[model samples]
Target: MLIEVIIKQYLDEHLDAPSFFDYPDNPPRRFVLIDRTSGGESERLPNSTVALQSYGKSKYEAMVLNDDLKKVMRNMEELNEISKVSLNADYNFTDLERKQQRYQAVFDIYHY
Candidate 1:
C-alpha cells in the first residue's frame, strides 16, 4: 500500500481538495476518492491501476478538479516509492442515480 500512501499524501499536499480511500459519511462539497482497481507484481515490483474520482458541486467544477489532479499526478514519479506514473484514462463518472457530479482519472502506477 505504499503507492496508495504516496498517492494520497501527494494529492493531499498538491491539490486543493481532500482525498480519501473510503467515502466519508459527511463529505465535503469537493473531494477526491482513491481506489485501486487492479494490480499485480512483476519480479517482486508492484504495479497497479488506480482510479481517482473527483467530486464537485457542478460538472464544470469536477472537470476542473480532475484536471488539476492530472497535472500533479504526472509528477508523482519524483516521489521516492513510486517509479513511474502513467494516466490510463479520465472521464466523466458522475453518479447519475445519486445525481452527483464526478470525474474519474485512471492511472498505471509502478512502484518498488
Candidate 2:
C-alpha cells in the first residue's frame, strides 16, 4: 500500500477522531489532516516526510491529539513495509487569523 494510505488506515483504526488527506466539507471539532510533504529513495530504500495536523476546538485538546498521534505512530515499526519511523519535529501550528487550534507533527518514515 502507499505510505499515505497505510498511515490513514492505521490512524483511523487507532484514533477516535476522523482523519483525512483534505479538509472535510463538514468537519468535526476534532480531526486530523495528513500531508506527505517530501520523499526520496536512497540505496533502494524509499523514505518520506509526512506532516500530520491535529485540530481541535481548544489548544489543550489539540495538544492531546498530537500526543495521541505520537503514541500510536511509535509502533509503526510493526508494519512490514516500514523499516523505521522517527519524529522529525512537532509544535503548535495554530492559525491565529482563522482561530483554529492545531498542532503539527512531522515524521520521517523509511520503507520498502
Report, for every candidate in turn, its global Cα lDDT versus the true structure.
0.93, 0.93
lDDT of 1 at 72: 93
lDDT of 1 at 107: 100
* Model 2: residues with Cα > 4 Å off, grouped in runs: none
Alpha-carbon RMSD of each model: 1.1, 1.0
TM-scores, all models, native as reference: 0.94, 0.95
lDDT at position 89, candidate 1: 97
**Per-residue lDDT of model 1, residues 1-112, tens digit only:** 5678889999999999999999889989999999999999988989999999999999999999999999999999998888889999999999886699999999999998
Expressed as tens digits, the lDDT of each residue in 45-80 for candidate 2 is: 999999999999999999999999999889888989
What would the C-alpha RMSD of candidate 2 be, to one decimal place?
Answer: 1.0
Query: Candidate 1: lDDT over CA atoms?
Result: 0.93
Highest TM-score against the true fold, candidate: 2
